[model samples]
Target: MYRCDCKSNVLSVLLYVSECWKFTANIEKRLEVFQTKCLRRIMRIFWPNMISNEELRRRAGVSTISEIIATRRWQWLGHVCRMPIDSIPRVALRWTPQGKRNRGRPKETWRRTVDRDLKTRGLTLQTAPTIAADRAKWRSLAVASSTRRRRED
Candidate 1:
């Protein structure tokens, strides 16, 4: 019942080592048949370093990335792989980055959300006046009142 500091179970850790060994054996056997000995062993053995064991599971046996999506575990695996940065689904992870906010803080536009139903009635901008217009009206009223005060004095 010893938990390795690497957070790997003893039995499963051994199984993972065995899987890596089997992978190397399979790769070597296939490559030997082709007579290509100059293949970089390190890259194939550990391709583009994954951050977690869950990600290792996803990469090792999951054939189609779409299979990962269908199971709805892609997001879990994505976080395990430190892949939350990419908005694209792993099935189509290479698509054009659309609506991605990169630089600076996100735009905090004051969208005028309404509680009224819009299905039957239409979108009508009835009396939502601009703040500047209201300010101007108040300023004109204040000026007129001050002028009246001076005349009364």
Candidate 2:
């Protein structure tokens, strides 16, 4: 596990988004040929033998950058869950600054993402904090949600 920095949460999310964009920039779409080539190139950096992308993915248990980011977010969420309600991390999670709405489509918030994740696991925002307090259960929920999403892809 890693320490969570509440102040750096937004920055960390941005960095994750940028890294994911960089990873997929070469591919126009997630076509199999492109995905295969990309995976092969990545694998070759660590192995010399020519191997089929399928074999490489199987051996490595392929996971997308988004999946990794989601895992990190969930871990941080668990940490926040364990904090006192008045603590900085927990306060940040619950805080809603009063501001006028922008004139265009609204920017996504971390709360929205958390809500979506919880919804996927048949959980509600009201119940999530309690569930997240149990490290093992929370970790399993995160993994199960990610695995379900992967299967849908």
Candidate 3:
């Protein structure tokens, strides 16, 4: 709810430290160092009843899941899928197939991938006579240039 940049250094650190108190599910490793208790005092300001540290730690642990849990943030995600409001996508996101390609950049287009493999491996492209003719034409032009140069000498 609060922007850290707008605040002083002390307030910024407190805000940053407060967020760290909540565990993230996306994190792969147990970053024990990043998990600190500086936010323990600050949380009491909002929840005066004071949720116990054990309960708090348990809640944080649950948030870091491989799949989305029954959280408030994702409540509208299901609706967003069912009723795609507009044909035009507001944002473009990179799509990557799992297992087939892991890490690094993923191929943007299926046509691009098929074309690349065909050209390099001489598979599908060998049957395409147009491509074959283009290569033959280029080779003939190169040979004709050399022959003309020899005649001038």
Against the true structure, what is each candidate's TM-score?
0.14, 0.63, 0.24
| lDDT tens digits by residue: candidate 1, 20-95 | 1212234434533322111112114344644443333233332122121212221232232233435553223233
Q: On residues 34-83, what C-alpha lDDT tens digit does candidate 2 reach at each position?
A: 44454555445345676765466565455454666577777877877788
Which residue runs of candidate 3 sit more than 4 Å off their true CA positions? 1-38, 43-52, 55-70, 85-99, 102-153
Q: Residue 138: error of model 2 in Å?
A: 1.0
Q: How much lDDT does each candidate structure score? A: 0.29, 0.62, 0.33
2 or 3, greater by lDDT: 2
Q: List model 3 lDDT by residue over 1-153, tens digit each.
A: 112322343233433422212224333133321222323332332356566544543544422211121121122222222333352321111233467655775444433533343344343422433433455543443345445544653
Deviating ranges (above 4 Å) for candidate 2: 1-38, 44-56
Position 124, candidate 3: lDDT: 49
Question: Highest TM-score: which candidate?
Answer: 2
Candidate ordering by lDDT (highest first): 2, 3, 1
Cα RMSD (angstroms) for every candidate in the order listed? 28.1, 8.4, 25.6
**Error of model 2, residue 90, in angstroms:** 0.6
